[model samples]
Target: MIRFDRVSKRYPPGLDALSDLSFEVAEREMAIVSGHSGAGKSTLLKLIAAVEKPTGGAVLVGGQNVGGLARSALPYLRRRIGMVFQDQKLLFDRSVFENVLLPLSIAGFPPRDAAQRVRAALDKVGLATREKALPIMLSGGEQQRLAIARAVVGRPNLLLADEPTAHLDRDTAADVARIFHQFHDVGVTILIATYAGELFPGARRLRLDHGKLMA
Candidate 1:
């Protein structure tokens, strides 16, 4: 679960990314954040993930104050959350399986268990047959699926995606949205920041405008 109380984020000398935003996302809930470019959607996601601290107010994830968390506790916090970016950030030199395996390896999971989880994650994203292939060899949609597999391999409790379908065609975007729906069905808290709301139906909508939440 996530809770933000009167949160604000100001960067550099005077740029206000978010101002007095407040919201709560319950466990096992799915929500879609929609806004124009530079509306602070990305910044809001970063606050939840602890990638950026709020300049004022408080951010709580699973009951811990993200802004007050010690540096040493960051890894533990991040382990409970999975994130996907618009760019897909896949390593061109690594095989699909390796990319998916990286998170497990970092968490020190046993090799056999990690292998099983990796394959399962790949299958979840419809990439089981392409595990041995490099990222550069896949189509845009396939690459994005691979990224999703990598993010979910650790079985994170919270899933956050920023502009997940920004580059895909309508059909492919639907495919990606279905993948997210699958995860949500199994009880993962899902929050996606997207410019296209039609891609996600039945999700609670949160809109922002010029750094302010639009009620």
Candidate 2:
């Protein structure tokens, strides 16, 4: 569902975040992007999501060229892809349900439909009972689960998570991993950027070093 054809991304200071990176993650496939800090894993995911454009080459999602898309067309493209950011990016002022509902609302989903979708997403992440709870009130792991719920509530065909399991107890990380496993079983294309490749052992690996794919 995602293809990077000779992609390169360079920052303002001539930092090459990704250099001629080429790879494909097929529809419904699970893959892990492994690399150390400054290895460009996050930039790769951003390119796929069209949050950042490539400096060169093409990023294709579902066969559509991401870099070539018009700004007005991005929302429709992004609706099919979910992202769980490294910071979780939850709104502390909102309740869990509201957080999950935000994406659908932004997409102009009807109020009734959005609420239903939000409830289902929370259930999937095992957070239904806590739907009314504020993000600040949740434990760290629960907060992480909340982020996952929000990402999937849009019913995205592809899910991209940046360091989903970082900074948590083993059991909590295991819990987060289990949630992703369920998503994979149901045929969501999954790509995760993480240092912990062992967390997703069955996933195919794409190793990056200094902005280049490692052999």
Q: Note the Cα lDDT for every prediction shown.
A: 0.93, 0.94
Model 2 scores worst on lDDT over the 10 consecutive residues at 195-204
**Model 2 pairs in collision:** none
Clashes of each: 0, 0
lDDT of 1 by residue, 1-215 (tens): 99999999999999999999999999999999998999999999999878899999999999899999988888889888998987888989999999999989989999999999999999999999999999999999999999899889999999999999988999999999999999999999999999988878978999999999999
Name the lDDT of candidate 2.
0.94
Model 2 Cα shift for residue 209 (angstroms): 0.3
lDDT, residue 149, candidate 2: 95
